[model samples]
Target: MHMVIYALVEASTKDEALAAGKTVFDRLVGTDAHSCAVFDYYVTFEEEDTSVAGKARWGDLPTAVPVDSDDGEELLDRGWEATKEEFERNLERVREALDEFSNEEIMRDEDLARHAFHQVGAYDGPMVFLYTEHASGIRHRGQLDRILEESENPWIVPADVHF
Candidate 1:
């Protein structure tokens, strides 16, 4: 089974964020390691309100996406169309749920951890939250910390990573 790990990568632009994410991924999982890649990367601009709103909007979307198996078979039993329709119908509710949280609450590691499938690093605000696919646990966090520390840019980017 595939597992996900999250990190806060400091970078100015989305391209820089993605590049940092790739570096982190390669360091943690290694170039010749198991099947792994940067699953998602988000870059937040300087404005706090804008960043929070953007994050809230992103938080409103559904996590599951339609996918096909290696044999060209549909994996989702309900099929993509039905699932998408359901997602669209429930978007308002999702937004409402997100609306309940304050900006500070939304960026809290404790709150974020509550929704994650695995352990995650701390988030401050308006930085890249890099999601990657790899085998990792609590211990991997130390390695991540080291990697971030060694870099010239600030280490931690604060944002929620939804599974």
Candidate 2:
């Protein structure tokens, strides 16, 4: 089973955003980590102010920003301990930015994405949008299947697992 939680946290300042992220990270770690695991992995959030950088405007080209990956390997290899730590750190940074900016706003309209993408992008708003592509559970399930296929572990590989 895959669970995806995307939220628009309200914070008065950039610091508050950081705090909120920390809180979220803690909450998710509890349920996501497997009890049998010796260590936990964490997901970290990274964000930057696009105010002066200029939002991605339609017909406007993207600057030559080097692409980077937070995790060097696939999700299945991100051990539990590392996953938890990374997640908590990401949230804290976002919360800090929230506290500093004093913007307790959330993108109220879901259609705002369409507006921002096609027409007026990123309104003069005090809100910050956050997203997490959680593939850990899916990858874990796949790994579990591989382990079972290779040997006789009581854990049955779910039919839903493609790999």
Instruction: Determine which window of 10 residues in candidate 2 has minimal summed lDDT.
Output: 154-163
lDDT to native, each model: 0.34, 0.28
Tens-digit lDDT track of model 2 for 1-163 = 2111222233444345444544443433443353222113222223233322222111222111111112211222323333344445544554544554433332332423323332222111111112212112312235444433553211100000000
lDDT of 1 by residue, 78-126 (tens): 2223333433444444454466766566567334523431212222111
TM-scores for all candidates: the values are 0.24, 0.21
Compared with the true structure, the alpha-carbon lDDT of candidate 1 equals 0.34
Point out the worst 10-residue segment of candidate 1 by lDDT.
119-128
Candidate 1: stretches off by over 4 Å: 32-163
lDDT of 2: 0.28
Instruction: Tell me which residue pairs clash in candidate 1.
Output: 123-158, 124-158
